[model samples]
Target chain A: MARWQPHASERLVAAALDLFEERGYENTTVIDIAERAGLTKSTFFRHFPDKREVLFGGDTLAGRLADGIADAPAAAGPLEAVAHALEALGRETFTAERREFSARRGAVIAANPELREREALKGLGLTAAMAEALERRGVPDPASRVAAQLGALVMTLAYERWSDPAGHDDFGEAVRQALAEVKAAG
Target chain B: MARWQPHASERLVAAALDLFEERGYENTTVIDIAERAGLTKSTFFRHFPDKREVLFGGDTLAGRLADGIADAPAAAGPLEAVAHALEALGRETFTAERREFSARRGAVIAANPELREREALKGLGLTAAMAEALERRGVPDPASRVAAQLGALVMTLAYERWSDPAGHDDFGEAVRQALAEVKAAG
Candidate 1:
C-alpha cells in the first residue's frame, strides 16, 4: 500500500489522539503532536489553535447543520427540518475513520473530569447555535429549542450506537431507528 | 425571625454557596465554609467529601426518578412513565426557593468550564441510569435508550426555561410544556 497524504486537519487529529493515548492528554504538548504529524508547528497551528482544539476543532459541523436546516423546505416542521439537517451533517462530518477517531477521543476526554466538562460545554454551545438557526427560519419559541435539542439528542444516541463495538450500522440508520423509537414511545 | 437549626448537610451547603458567591469558588476554603456554617471541620467532612460536592449534592434526584419509573403502573408506556416520574421528582426536588438557587448555581457553573463539564457528566450519568431502569421495566432495545435520552432532553430544555429570568412557572409545568411541544413537532 502507498503512503497517502492525509488532510492537514485529519493528520493533526490523528497525531493528537496518538500522543494523548501514549503519553496522556495532560502530558502531551502541541509541539509533540505537530512533530508526530510530520508537520511544523506553524502547519499544526494553521489547522488547530491548541491541543484542546485537536479534540474540538471548531464548529464546522454546527455551521453545516445550521446551513442544512436553513435550506430545508419551508413546509417541513421544526423537528423534521432539524432532523434532516442532523442527518445531512452526520453524513458529511462522520466518516468511518472519523467515527473511530471520535470514539477514541470521547474515551480520552471521559477519563478526565475537566476535559469532560469542556466537551459538555461544547455540546451545549452547538445546541444553542442550532436553535438559533432554527429560530432564524421562523421556527417559533420553545419549539425551536426543543427541536434543536431533540435533533442533537438523537444524533448523540446514534453516534453512541455507531461507536459501540457491537454497533455495525451506518449513522443514518441509527438515527432513524432512534427517532422511530421515540415516536413509538410517544 | 426565629433561628432554626439546619441539618449539618444543609448548613454546610448554605455556607458553601454563600462563601462561593462572596469570595468565589476558588478563594473560599473548606475551613471558611465550616466556620460560617457553625460546624467543625469533621462535621463538614462527614456531610461532604469535597468542595464540588457542595455544589452538586442533590444527585439523588436521579435515583428517585429511577425508583418512580420502576414503580410506575404497567399500563403506562415508557414515555408516560418517565414523564410521571419527572413530574413527581420535579415537584419534590425543585421548590420555588430551590429553583432560584439552582438558577444561580447554573449561572455560576456556566461561568466556569470545569464546573459545567462536571454538571454535564452528572446529567449523562443520570440519563444512563434511567435507561438501565427502563430496560429493567422491559422497555426493549432502542426504546429504552431513546426514552431515557428524550426524557433528559426534555429536562434540559425545561431547565433552560426554568433558569431564565422570565421563567416564573414551576419546573413540572415547564417540563410538560416542553414535552407537549416535542409531541406536536413530531
Candidate 2:
C-alpha cells in the first residue's frame, strides 16, 4: 500500500508530522521530512510545495465537500446536504490514526501565529467555496450564506473538539452535538 | 472633550486611522500620528502601546461583548443574549466614521499575512471568551459551543459585509441578515 503513488502523499504527511513533532515546525525542513519518509527532496516536493503545506493537505477536502453538497439528493435541504458532505469527508479525513496527527498539527498551528492565520484563511476560502457551491445549486440569498456560515461554524467547533484531549468525541458526533445544542437553545 | 483621558484614546485612534490612510499602516509612525492628533508622544503612548494598537483599539470589544452576554436579561436565550451583546458593542465600537476606517484596516490586514493571522487570533480569543461567558451563565454543553461559534460567525459575516462597498447595510443589520439566512437555510 505504501508503494502506491496515492499513498505516497500520505507517507510524506506522516513523515512530516513525525518530524515536526520531534523537531519544531520551524526546525524541521523539507529534506528532513523526505529523509524520514525514505524518499528524496524531489519526491517530497512532488507531493507538496513546501513544508507548511504538509499540515494542510486537507485543503482539497473543502472542494470535495462542495462537490458532495452539489451532488446531494434532491430531498436533502441545503444544510442537510452540506452536513452529509462534511460528515463523509470527516469520516475519510479524520480517521482514528489521523486524529492524533490532526490534533498535533492543530496544536502546532495554534502555537505559530503565521500558521494559524494561514489556517484561518483556508477556512474562510472553504466557506466561500461552499457558498458558491450552494448558489450554483440554486439555493437563494440567505440560504447560501447561512449554509456557508453554519458549515464553517460546525467545522470550527468540530475541529476544536477533535483537537482537545477532553473532547473525546469524534468529529461527526461533535458536529451533531453542536447542531443539537443550537436547536435545543433555540 | 479631547482633554479627557477617555477622549484622548479616541483622538489617538482617529489620528492613527487618518495617518494610516494617508501614508499607509507600515509607513505611518507613532510620532506622525501623535502630531496629527495635536498630542505629545507621551500622550499617544499613554493611550496606545504602539501604532498598530491604534488600529485595533477596540480589541476589548470582545471582552465587553462577553460581559454583555453574561449579563443579558434572563428572557433572552443564549444565542439571543450573544446577539444582543454583539449589537450593543456594534453601537458603541463601530461608529459610522469607523466603518470606512474599518474597511481600509481590513484591507491592510488582508494584504499582510501577519496582520491577517493576528486578526484570526483576535477572533479566536473573542470566540473563546464568548464560550466561557456562556458556560458561566449555565448554558449547557452544545448550547455554549453553538452560541459562541454562531456569535463569531455572525461577527465575521457582519465585518465582511461592512468592509465591502456593495454591503451598504449597517453592522447590526448585516448580523441580523446573517442570522436570518442561517435560519432560512436550516
Candidate 3:
C-alpha cells in the first residue's frame, strides 16, 4: 500500500458525497467515508476536520473571490467588478467539468440541516469578503454592503442555473443573466 | 417550588443570555441556565431544545413577518409590502422595551462562532419566509427573490441601528432609513 496517495483530498470528498447521498448525511460517518475512499481514518482526518468540512472546501473559495474582486479593472463599477470576479470564477473554479459534481454537492447540502447551516455561514463569509474587497477599492459604507449582498445573490442564482442538469450555459453567462434579472427587479 | 411558572420561557432565555455572556456559550450548560432562571432543567428543556436556541425564539418572528406581509394593502408593491411587514414588527416584536435585551443578545451571538452560524442560518430562514410570502402575492420568480433579499438586508441594517445603545430611532424608522439607503445604493 502507498504511504501517500495523490488527489487524496478529492477522493475523500467524492467518497463522502457518495456516502452522504446513498445513506444520508446523518447515517454516514467518518469511518465509513474513509473506508469508501480506501484510506485510513487518520488520512481522512488529515484532509478535513470532519464530514461537514469535507464539502465546504475551507476558505479557499472566499480567498479566490476576494482576489478576483481586488484584481478587477479600476474603471469598473461595483456590480461590474463583481461580474468580472464571477467571470474569473467561471474560468478558474466553476469550470464546465465541475458542473455535475456541483449539482450533486448542492443536492446533498439542500437535504441536510447541518450542511445547510454550514452553507449559510459560508455564504455570509463570501459576502463579507466581497464587501471588504469593495471597501478597499474605495466604495463607501452601505453601498459596498448593498453591492456585496446583490453580488452574493447573483452568484447564488447563477450557480443554481449553471448546476441544473438540463441547463447548458456556463457559470459566467448564468451570472450575467441573474444579475440582469436582479437589476430589472430592483 | 411551583411547577407552573409564569413567563418561564422568557426567564429561561434571559438567564441563558446572561450566562452565555459571563461564561461564554461553550462553557455554559443547560443546567446552569436553568438554575440561573430558578427553573428546573426539564422546564428549560421544555422551553428550548438547547441553550443555543434560547435566544432564537423559534419561528415566531418568521410567522409574524409572513403574516404582516400577507396583510399588507392590495395596492402595495413587493418592497412596499416588505416595509409594511417591518413596521408591524416594530409595533409587535422589536418593541422599544426589548431594545436593551436585543443589544445584549446580539453581542453574545457576535462573540461566539456557533451562535453566529445559527444566526446566519436563521437569517436565511427569514429571507426564505419573506420570499415565499412575496410569491404568494403573485410576485414573479427572481423578482420575488430579489425583493426578499433586499428586504432582509433592510431588516438587518435597521435592527443594528435600533439595537445600538446610542441610537434613538424606533425599529420602523430605522427600517425606513435603511430602505432608503438600500434604494440609493441600488
The candidate maximizing lDDT is: 3
Q: A76, model 3: CA deviation in Å? A: 1.4
Chain A TM-score for each candidate, in the given order? 0.88, 0.86, 0.96
Worst 10 residues of 2 chain A by lDDT: A177-186
Give the winner by lDDT: 1 or 2.
1
DockQ of each: 0.29, 0.32, 0.80
lDDT of 3 by residue, B1-186 (tens): 677889999899988988888889999999999999988999988888987899898999899989999999999999989999999999998999999999999999999988887898889999999999999999998888888988999999999999999885599999999999999988
lDDT of 1 at B160: 84
- Arranged by TM-score with the best first, the candidates are 3, 1, 2
* Candidate 1 per-residue lDDT over residues A48-163, each given as its tens digit: 77778788878887788889899888998876787788678557777666777777888899887767766777777778788899999998866787677677677777778887
Worst 10 residues of 3 chain B by lDDT: B160-169
Clashing pairs in 2: none
DockQ of 1: 0.29
Error of 2 at A121 (Å): 3.9
TM-score of each: 0.79, 0.75, 0.95
Q: DockQ of candidate 3?
A: 0.80
lDDT of 1 by residue, B1-186 (tens): 223346878888878888878878888888999899998777777777888878888668778889978988899887777888878867788766688788778877886766776788788787878888899999886677767767877788788888776884588898898778666754
